[model samples]
Target: MTIAPRDLLRRMFDAAIAAAQPARCVPACLPEPPKGRLVVIGAGKASGAMARAVEDHWPGALSGLVVTRYGYKVPCERIEIMEAAHPVPDAAGLIAAKRIQKLVSDLTADDLVLCLISGGGSALLALPLDGVTLEDKQAVNRALLRSGATISEMNCVRRHLSAVKGGRLAAACAPAKVVTLLLSDVPGDNPMDIASGPTAADPTTCADALAILQRYAITVPRTVLEVLESGRGESVKPGDPRLAGCQTRMIATPQMALDAAAAVARAAGYPVHILSDRIEGEARDVGSVLAGIALQVAGRGQPFTAPCVLLSGGETTVTVRGSGRGGRNVEFLLSLGIALNGQPGIHAIAGDTDGVDGLEEIAGAHLGPDSLSRAWELGVKPKDRLADNDGHGFFETLGDSVVTGPTLTNVNDFRAILIER
Candidate 1:
């Protein structure tokens, strides 16, 4: 059966999303009823869906609060789902963070704190340290995001500045078994990095957060600096007594998403090639390199012949040099288009698997051989847009941004394409 390249590309992306759907991942990882009370807590874009998953799978009296990004809520039987600001946290997040902190503090040794953590939780569950207000945290967070810092580095600073993160949430539930069900969105999938590791032991220290701040050249108030320098609110260490019963289990990840896309490609009469699930570096550079590989396959039939899909999953970083809207996925596509120079019959799509890329509402963008031509007719100039880091804007004008709202689950970035005659 012959398949259109665009159709095959969509199939690959859809399969990736289906594989990482929260409904399938969140249910089976839930813990049974505890000996005493069961306290459910979580924060992320997926927290709402995770809460709903737990309610459907676990049959017991459960009560707790979870914070998710606005417009990412799912109906839950008992767990309270609170909508908060994401990418940049807001006042709603501040209140929810305090509430969850108080909830964990009330836990007894016999109780079980089932903590559901995923990507975007760091900004969603915002409880700033004493003397450091939410505004302070917000300022720092906003700067770090565009500083080209890796996820690990950005999270390192976040863990130190929060009252609920860096193991403090687990510390509050001392004596109670804190079991964290994590759906990793960050490469390396470090528990300490996901949502800043709210219920896991933190290996990063206050000094480390300060060092990151220095590396990024982020300027904060003296009070915020003092709090970090004093080390008064350091997170639970690896062997802290309060974390003796804390545990973390990864339920979903980027590899799983890549595998799913690969399956679709193979079944669609195309040779599947997975580049890397942990890919990272500058977004535009990654795009240029991928374009080279596509050219090789399309022109010389090297790597893989026609009717092959190249797949990759990983977080890509973008250094903000322009005052325009930017997302890693869109940036990649814009760069890819420039490199390809409208090379015929090489179609592609690049997007965040979670259905939101960077700060935009679009999940990602889809491209065809005529994408540049369509974009040109739409008055889109590839070089000018890329120079401004306005890839989202470029795609938006061309009517190519793939907006799926919130998929409510994040495995990281997904990139796939079909090269054909």
Candidate 2:
């Protein structure tokens, strides 16, 4: 009943994703039906699945619309599921954002608006403010993705530039109670950071968004900059009466996913070490640090003894310097492999829990002691690929890319390192 290292790593990743599935986590967090209407609306990679979960659990009548990434839709009889672009804004997303705004605009105090939110919602709920076009938002999004800006910073800019984000959606349903069930994908699980807090109050402002754009040197349309400078795009501030009745609960999180993976490792007879689930930074640098820890455990047995597994969950960024397919998980794995330098008995897997890393449909990849050697034999230079931010290309060439079409849930990134004596 012994599992190979790769199999064990894959099993651990499966366990992590299973822990955050909307079907399992959505049932318990659902609120009671309101007196008037129960309107279900949301946006994210997981919102379609979450909407289905709500449909299965609720006994009363409910209807609404939700937008998810293309290929992530789930069937629901009452709630309308729409597909849109992710990591970038599109016309379909713009239409859905407008529909969502209209759906809750006239809700009475007795009505309830249940918003299902997760990663990718920020892009899926795109509705640029006045004078800002979808193309403008898309340009800024591309810049942010390539700028290596943290999720919070990128989202802050998105929140300020959008017509429906940053509590504006909740403000639209002022009289109705907003109960937001969040599958958190950001570090610290801040409600305002999840999907740009469409149903929660925002403390960040236009000045803040301007600062982020400047800090990252992200070039945007001049009017977009003017919107921030004129405070025309200022988000709903804290203590806004519009959000007074808004209720937010984080139903799933990165820490929860990491804990589930730890359980799997322990059950498999490996001593489990749970690292910080909030780890965030440049992906390659973080990979090198984790490699150092793995090397320590494998070589000196320091920190933790051999035959142990190290688990961590958190979103990492990649500042794309080269014009190649870039994914944070693969970048991390590539860097880890380079630092390990063919260290024996140390294997690793890194992937996004949502089943896609960066803009690619590939989830992530795995690394072994022979990964470097195999790449060399295949005429692939690992260091050059890493420098070009081409982790996906490198792994695909080695036939090590992990591709899981769509998991319908997102708790952020998962990383597991197996050290055996």
Candidate 3:
């Protein structure tokens, strides 16, 4: 049976997401039950699912709270699952953050604090420092999101301004051993970068956050700037005594997801090439570069020949210069389609594993050899939409948007390009 390019690409993407589901990855990473209480606390798009996995597997009594995106909650009787905004901080997040901090306070050495962290926790675990208000954090988050800054850079700034992040959460749980199970969604899978390392020590300093703000030309509230300038926002650094008993386990990662997708391609009888699970930069620029590689394979057959699939996973940024709806995955696909210029026998799919791209609930989009022509027929100017930073708008109009709702897992963005002769 011959598999269509689009169907094969979708299957590959689904395989990637399935490999990172909390139920599949969290159970094995659960730490041994503590001598005393087992308290669970977490924040992320997948925290609810992670908490559920723990409840289903834990032998002892466990009770705690976890905050996730508004629509990403999974039912858990023991672990309270709270919903909050993502990609931006909100009052609900602030309240949850405060409650979460309080839950870990005054713990005993025999007790265990299990921290389940994943992508979007930085915003979901929103607790500003003394001088910084919730409003200030929210504003800074907006600025950072629009600044085209890398995830690590944005998270560095976030850690300095938050009271619960940057190892402070772990510090608060001092005396109680902290066991962090991470579903890494950032490039390189640095524990500190995942959810700004709420339960992990931070090596970055206030100066680094300040420099990032200046580099991105992002202006923060006066209180935010004051906190950074006065060094009052310093996060717990590595080697802190409070973090000595903390342990982090990366249960899922982009490389793992990419490998899963590669397996699907191999089983489908197509040779697979995983470019890099850590690709980064502006979405459009990366799309163009990948298109060049696909073109090379399609025309010259130099790099692995034809009838192959190119896979990559990473977080991409968008400058957001236009007024249209934007998603990095859609932006990438739009750019790739424009570069391909309707070239035959080349098809691609790009989507966030968590079922969201940019601020939209839609996962991402798909592109084919006729994508550009179809857009023209629909009176949609691909370049114009790309200029407007409206990849979601462009793809949606062409009926190519990939909507997966909430996959209950996140390992960053997944991209697959299939080339056939």
Highest lDDT among the candidates is held by which one?
3
TM-score quality measure for candidate 2: 0.99
- In model 2, the Cα lDDT at residue 27 comes to 97
lDDT of 2 by residue, 132-244 (tens): 99999999999999998999999999999998889999999989999999999999899888888888788888999999988987789998988999999999889999889
Q: What is candidate 1's lDDT per residue for 206-271, written digit by digit as tens?
A: 899899889878887787799889997588789989999988889999899889888878887778
1 versus 3: better TM-score goes to: 3
Model 1, runs deviating above 4 Å: none
Q: For each candidate, give its TM-score against the true structure.
A: 0.96, 0.99, 0.99
TM-score of 1: 0.96
Q: On residues 238-309, what C-alpha lDDT tens digit does candidate 3 reach at each position?
A: 999999999999999999999999999999999999999999999999999999999999999978799899
Q: What are the lDDT figures for the candidates, one per model?
A: 0.87, 0.93, 0.94
